[model samples]
Target: MSLTAPARLGIQLQPQHATYGQIRDAVLRMEDLGVDVVFNWDHFFPLSGDRDGLHFEAWTMLGAWAEQTERVEFGTLVNCNSYRNADLQADMARTLDHISAKGGDTGRFIFGTGSGWFERDYDEYGYEFGTVGSRLDDLAEALPRVKARWAKLNPGPTREIPIMIGGQGEQKTLRLVAEHADIWHSFVRPDAIAHKLDVLARWGERVGRDVSEITVSNELSRGRLDDDHADALYDAGVRLFTLGISGPDYDDAPVQHWLAWRDRRNDAVGVDAA
Candidate 1:
């Protein structure tokens, strides 16, 4: 947002209320529209509309995404840590990294993950719906395992896949971000972002790793990106802005509007120098 790096637009194309073919078509359209990343949530059922609406799984769909598009990075908006073995998650992510690599170029994968939430996913999938503290502790422990596994992987990840951790829990989440995250994604309000970053910096100090280079990413709710608050968000150092789109419709008008807004903000960088 400071023009130190141009703002990147990402979309969480919600995988519900439509067929897989519809979802695949929408992905290609998003890539054609030039969004930087495309994300899907790691949920077992629809998060909106009918409780049992037509929905799809996350990782398997991602396997298709790697081959469906030649550009645009893709991953879960935040994978549920409780859903799979930590080492298995690492292997799946690494496999995606290799699958997306084409034309002899680096892979297009962002390992965006989080401590599991959505009890229904756990309940239905037979995973232990543990307490919040336990879940966070599991994530804290799993992060290191995920990294260790990458090193032992055969034909290791083509690139050190960027880790994007979601959530702003002041204690565990932020500390995890301090130690491992390359991108810290949150939905914090404009007024709250500065404080969150301050807390993050404190954690960075405690962990003894400079957190200044970590990309600050924020999500914009449907139709919210044009608000004056976006100025506050940019001023707060948010460089990646993501919005969510749902299936059946996959209405991209909001995405188009935000992309235009992204261009205007980026163009100002040149104007400032001129």
Candidate 2:
């Protein structure tokens, strides 16, 4: 199996009641900070304490992010696949790919996605939430269609848009990752992730693919990923670590340590050259 690892740092800029101007500036700042990838969650409204809170739609901001940032690759950490028509999602991705590649380079876009989760999103928008199983089933069905649409779309994504699947259900999600994702993001803790990854490997074997092509990623939680804890995740093959922070008022304080750790990992793991 190939053993190449992804660059070890990404930052998720959560749109927690932030003004568009603030978010725009923050994206530029994150690129300046040498972050590899910048991400935003896909939700119509905030998912935090106050449900009835300010928020922004995912793709519109991504188009702006594509134009605003010069270096860092950007994407939604997890766009809800069910919200937009799969064909439309393909079109949006294709346009953003060109937007990011404006000056003549391969696109810096990762098409991260997951099945829709928030019931509020469905209830308000008139989508059927159905069952969790049903949603995942829909995701499994939609992914290939989305990919097919990507190929058929005009301009065709300036580059291959890496597919990022986020979830940890061993039965369904991991299998989907083995079959489709170029990257897999999950909340699995380091130790638990080790076990689950073995399952993913088995799925890869079953499907005649190499698991190494899929980078393992996990959330970089402030409360959980202490210095030693970060090391543990690295040891478990989680090279793409993402720190999710909030807005209106942006704070990089919680992520400074993680950033430092990423540098340290780079030094030790050859990401210094990435």
Candidate with maximal lDDT: 1
Evaluate model 2: give its TM-score: 0.95
- Please give the range of 10 consecutive residues that has the lowest summed lDDT in model 2: 1-10
Backbone clash total for model 1 is 0
Give the number of the best model, judged by TM-score: 1
Cα lDDT, all candidates? 0.90, 0.84
Check candidate 2 and list the clashing pairs.
none
- For model 1, where is the 10-residue window of minimal lDDT? 265-274
User: Can you tell me which runs of candidate 2 are displaced by over 4 Å?
Assistant: 1-7
Could you tell me how far off, in angstroms, the CA of residue 234 lies in candidate 2 after the best superposition?
0.3
Question: Superposing every Cα of model 1 onto the true structure, what RMSD results?
Answer: 2.3
TM-score of each: 0.96, 0.95
198-261, model 2: which lDDT tens digit per residue?
8999999998998877888887766565777777877888878888877776776656667777
